[model samples]
Target: MSETNDTGTAAPAPVSNWNVPNALTTLRIVMVPFYGWALLVDGGDSVAWRCVAWFIFGVAMITDKVDGDIARKRNLITNFGKIADPIADKAITGMAFIGLAIIIDTWWMWAITVVVLVREWTVTLLRLSILKRVVVPAAQSGKVKTAAQAVGLGLLTLPLLEVDGWLDVPGEVVYGFALVILGIAVVLTITSGYEFFREVWRQRHEIREKSPERRK
Candidate 1:
C-alpha cells in the first residue's frame, strides 16, 4: 500500500538503511580504532604487530570495495551510504597515513600526509554542503588515488627487513617503492580535489540559473 499526499499523488518511499552494503560500511567505521591500535600498539616496531596492522588494513580496504559493489549490484544505494561510505574510506586510510607518518618519523611523510588529509577533508566538506542538490560519484582518478594509498600503506605497514630474509630483498628498496606510490597518490589527490571543486562550481551555477528568483 502506498501513501498519498493531499492532492492524491503518491509519496516517495524512504531509503532503507538495513542492507548488506550499509552493514559493511558500518563495520568499516567500527574497525578504524582497532586498525589504529594494531598499527600503533608496538610503536610500529614489532614485526608481528606490523603484520597484524597490515592485515587489518587490507581487510578494511576490501570491505570498501565489497560494499560499493554490493550497493550498485543490489540496487541498495541510499543517502546514508553515499555520505557514510566515503567517510569510512577516509577514516581508515587517514588513520593509516597518520600512523605511518608517526611510525616513520620522517618530515616528508608527515608533510605528504598532512597535504592529503587537508585535501580530503576540504573536498568532503564541499561535497556535504551541496549533497542534497548534487551527487558527485567517485571518479576514476579518485579510485586510482585510493588504490595507490592502500598499496603504499600496505607496503609501509610491513616490517620489511625485520621479517625473515627469505625474499632476500633490501628494506630500502621496498621502502623506496612504497614512497613512489605514495607520491603518486598525493598527486592524484590534488588533481581529483581540483576536479571536485570544478564540478561543484558548475553545479552551483546550474542551481542558481534554475532558481525561480533568477528567472524573474
Candidate 2:
C-alpha cells in the first residue's frame, strides 16, 4: 500500500504543492533500483557498495519523513497515498531485510523478515475488506509499527554501512543488537496488525447495526 495525500479537493490542479509528497514517493521508488544494484550487482559487502546502499537506504528513510510532512502541511493527503505509501515502504524494507538475512546467513533474520512482511501484507487486505463497511483511519499503534520497522531496518543495514579505512564494530555486537531490536519490532508489528484488524471489525459491526438493511 502506498501512502496517499488527503487533499480533499475534488478537482485539484495537476501541479500543486501536493507535488512534494508525490515527488518524494517517486524518489523512493527510484532509489529501490539503485539500492538493489548496490546489494546484488555491486558486491553489497564491499566498502563502495556499502556506501551506495547506505546512502540509498538513508534517502529512502528520509523521504518517508518528507512525504508525510508534505502531505500534512500541504493538506495533500489522498487515499492513494494512504494505500501506496505503506506498500512502497514494505517493498523497500522487505528487500533490505531479506537481502541481509541471505547475506548474514541468519535464519532468525529471515523469520523476522517474513513476520514483518506478513503483517504488512495482511493489513492491506484486512483494511480493504473492512473499508467496505466502514472508514478505517490509521491508528497510533500502526504508526508505532512503522517507526519500529524503520529503526529495525536501519540497524540491520549497519553491515552495509562498512567503509574502507573506517572503524567497523565487532560483528557479534552489531548482529546481536540488530536481532534483539528486530525481534521487539516484529512483536509490535504483529500486535499492531491485529489491533488494526480488530478495530476494523468493530467498526464494521457498528455500521451494520445502524444500517436499515440489517433490520430486514
Candidate 3:
C-alpha cells in the first residue's frame, strides 16, 4: 500500500482503513438494520417510528457523503472503504426500496425495486471485481441517479402520504414528487449501468489490443 514519493526514495506511509471516514462508513452500515426495523414497525404505519427511520436514513446519507469527502481530503482511502462504502450505500437504499414495496404493496413498487436493485448490485459487483484492472469513471447519469434516489427514497421513507393528518394534502404533493423522482432514478440506473459496462469492456479491450503479446 505504500507508494514512492519523488526521487525514488523510501515510500510514503500507507493509508489505513482505521480512520475517521471508514468509521463513519461503518457506522452507516450499522444503522441499516435499525432503520429497517423502525421503518417496518407497525407495518410502516407508526408516525413516530417512520420519523425515526427517516432521521436515520438522512444521517446515513449525510455520512455517505461525508465519508467520501473526508477520505479523499485526508488520503484515507482503503480497500475496506472501497468495498464497504458502496455496500453501505446500497444496503440502506436497498432496504428502503424493499421496505417501501412491502408496506405499499403496489405492483410498480415491487417491479421497480426488483429492476433497480438487480442493476445496481450487478454494476457494483462488476466494478469492484475490476477495480484494479479496468478504471471506469462515474457517469453523470450515475450521479443524478444517486441524488434522485436518495431524495426520493428519503421522502418516501417518511409517513407523509400514508398517514392522514394536517399534512395530508402537502404530503400527497410531496409523495407524488417523490414518485416522479424515483421514476427518473430508475431510468438513470439502467442507463448508467449500461454506460459503465460498455466503458469497462472498452478499456479492457484497449489494454489487450495495446499489449506486447497482442501486438506481436
Candidate 4:
C-alpha cells in the first residue's frame, strides 16, 4: 500500500512482520526439535514418551493450521511467515517419517518414508523457489494430502506396536488404519506434486509466449 506525497508520487508504507500468525509460525518451528526428541526418546518404544511426542506433534500441527487461518483472515501474511511456515511443516513431518521408519526397522517402512520425504521436500523447495514468480494455489487433493498426512502421521506417532497382550490387537488394528491413510496421503502427495509442477511450467510458458521481446 502507498500514499501520495506532496509531489504526488506514491510512497510505500512498510508493514510490520511481527504479528500473531508469525508468532505461531515461529512457535511451530521451535517445537520441531523438541518434538523430534520426544519421538525418539526411548527409541520411540515407551508408551508414555510416545504419547508425549504425539501431544507435541498434535499441538504443532494445530498451530500450523491456526497460523495460516489467522494470517489469511487478519491479513497478517508476511515474507517471513511464508518461508518459516513450510520449513516448520516439513521439518516436523520429515522427522516423523524418518523417526518412525527407524523405529519400525522394516525395509517396507523405510521405502515408504524415503518416497514420501523425497516428494515432500522437493515440492516444498520448488514452492519457495517460485514464491514470487508464480502463485500456485493448493488444489483440493493437496489439501486432502495435508490432512491425511497429519492424521496418519499423528496416529503412527503413538506406541501402536509396543502395547502387549490384550491391547496388542487393537493397537495393530489402529496402526493398520493409520497405514491405509498414510498410503492414501502418499498417492495424493505424488499426484498433487505433479499437478503443481505442471501448473508452474504452464504459467511460465505462457509468460514467455506473451513476451513481445521474444516474439520480435
Candidate 5:
C-alpha cells in the first residue's frame, strides 16, 4: 500500500524494501537457541565454546541494530515487524539470562530472569490486545531497559572467558557487577511495562466511553 506524507505528496510502494529487514529479523531469532546451547548445555569449561558463544551474542546484538536501521531507512516497517521484533528480542535475551543462571547456578539470576520474562510477556499481551485500536510505540524507558539487559547479559557471560592470572580482578567481582546491572534492568523493565499498560488502559477506557452501548 502507498502512504501519503503531510504535504499530500504520494509515497512510493513499500513492498520492494520490506523483505530484507524481515530476513535480518529472522536471523536474529535463529541465534537464540545456539546461544542457549553454547552457554547452558555445553559440557566442560572449554574456553573455545565460551568465545564462540560470546561472539554469537555480539553478532546477534549487531543484527538488532542493523534490522531496525534498515527498516527505518527503507520504510520497511510492517505489521510482521511490529510483532516479530519484540518476540525475537525477548526470546534471545530471556534465554540468555536463564542460560546464564543455569551455568552460574545462582538463585538471584533465576529470579531476575523470571522478573524480566514476566514484564516482557505482559507487555506483549497488552500490545496484541490493543493493536487494532492504537499503536503502542516503543518508549524511551523501554529502550533503556533493553540496553541495560544487553550489557548485563554480556557481563554475565564474561566469566566464560579464560583469561590468565595476569588479569587483575576476580571473576566473582565481575559477576557481582553483572548482578547489580541486572537488578537495575529489572526495575526499568517493570517501570516501562507499567507505563505501557497505563497507556493501554487509558485508550481502552476512552474507547469504551465513546461506544454506542455507553451512550445509553
Candidate 6:
C-alpha cells in the first residue's frame, strides 16, 4: 500500500516495526513495572532497593536515547515509533516522578509532578487528535525538558542521602540541585506545550484554507 504525495506520486513505503528501535522501545515499556516495583515496593527506603530502582531507571533512559538516535540515523522512522516512542518515554519518566513524590511525601513535589503529568498527557492527546493532519516534530525545548527530567529524576531516584557519608556530600545540596533541575523541566514543559498548540492551530488553519469549500 502507498500514500499519494503532493505531486500525485506514490510515497515511500512505511518502515517495518521489527527494527531495533522499536524493540528498544518495547523493552523500555517492559522495564517500567520493574522499575516501579523496585522504587515503591520498599517505600524507597532501603538503600539496596533504591539503587536497584535507579539502575533500572537509568537503563530505560539510556534506551530512550539509543532508540531515537538509531531510528533517525538508520532511517527506521515509522508511525509506530513516532507515536509509541513518546508514550514510552512519558511512561518511564512519569512513573519516576510520581514514585519519587510518593516516596518523598512532599506536597510541592507532588504538585509539580501533577502539573507536569497533566501537561504531558494533554499535549500527547492533542498531538494524537491531529496526527493524521499534521506532523508535529519534537522541538528542541521538548528534548531539553526530557533530558532535564531524566537527570533530575535519576539523581532523586538514587539513595543519595543514604550515601552522603560515603560521598562526603551533603544530601541537602544534592536534593536542592535535583529540585532545581526538575523546576527547569517544568518551565520547559509549559513553554513547549504552548509551542505545540500554536503549531496545531497553524496547521489547522492551513488545512481549512485549502479546503474545497474555502477554495470555491
Best by lDDT: 3
Task: Give all TM-scores, in the order shown.
Answer: 0.88, 0.80, 0.94, 0.92, 0.85, 0.88
lDDT of 5 by residue, 1-216 (tens): 569989899877656434887888888899988887777535525556666777788888888989999888977898888788878887888878777767766777678778878889878866766468966688999999889888888877665245557453576577678778888889999999988888878887898999999999
Query: Who wins the TM-score comparison?
Result: 3
Model 5 clash pairs are none
Error of model 3, residue 4, in angstroms: 7.1
Backbone clashes in model 4: 0
The number of clashing residue pairs in model 6 is 0
True lDDT of residue 116, candidate 6? 93
Candidate 3 C-alpha error for residue 209, in Å: 1.4
lDDT string, candidate 4, 44-157, tens digits: 888988999999999999999999998989778888988889999999899899988988889988998898889888888988885567788989999999999999999999
Q: lDDT by residue for model 2 over 1-216, one digit each (tens)?
A: 333457744554443435678778877877787786676544456656755676788889899898989798978877667666766777788788777767666777678778877878777766555476566687787777777777766766655245323345465466567677677778888888887778878987888898899988
The total of clashing pairs for model 5 equals 0
lDDT of 1 by residue, 117-164 (tens): 999988887676645787677789988998999998889888775665
**Tens digits of lDDT, candidate 6, 76-118:** 9988887888899889988998899998898988998999999
TM-score of 2: 0.80
> Of 4 and 5, which scores higher on lDDT?
4
Computed on alpha carbons, the lDDT of every model, listed in order, comes to: 0.87, 0.72, 0.92, 0.89, 0.79, 0.88
Clashes of each: 0, 20, 0, 0, 0, 0
Off by over 4 Å in 4: 1-13
- As for candidate 3, its clashing pairs are none
Q: What is the lDDT of residue 118 in candidate 1?
A: 96
By the TM-score metric, which is better: model 3 or model 5?
3
Better of 3 and 5 by lDDT: 3
Off by over 4 Å in 2: 1-18, 41-43, 128-132, 160-171
lDDT, candidate 3, 1-216, per-residue tens? 557779887786877778999999999999999999999998999999999999999999999999999999988999999999999999999999999999999999999999999998988898788557888888999999999999999999999867777889999999999999999999999899989889988988899999999988
RMSD of candidates 1 onward, in order: 2.5, 5.8, 2.1, 2.4, 3.3, 3.1
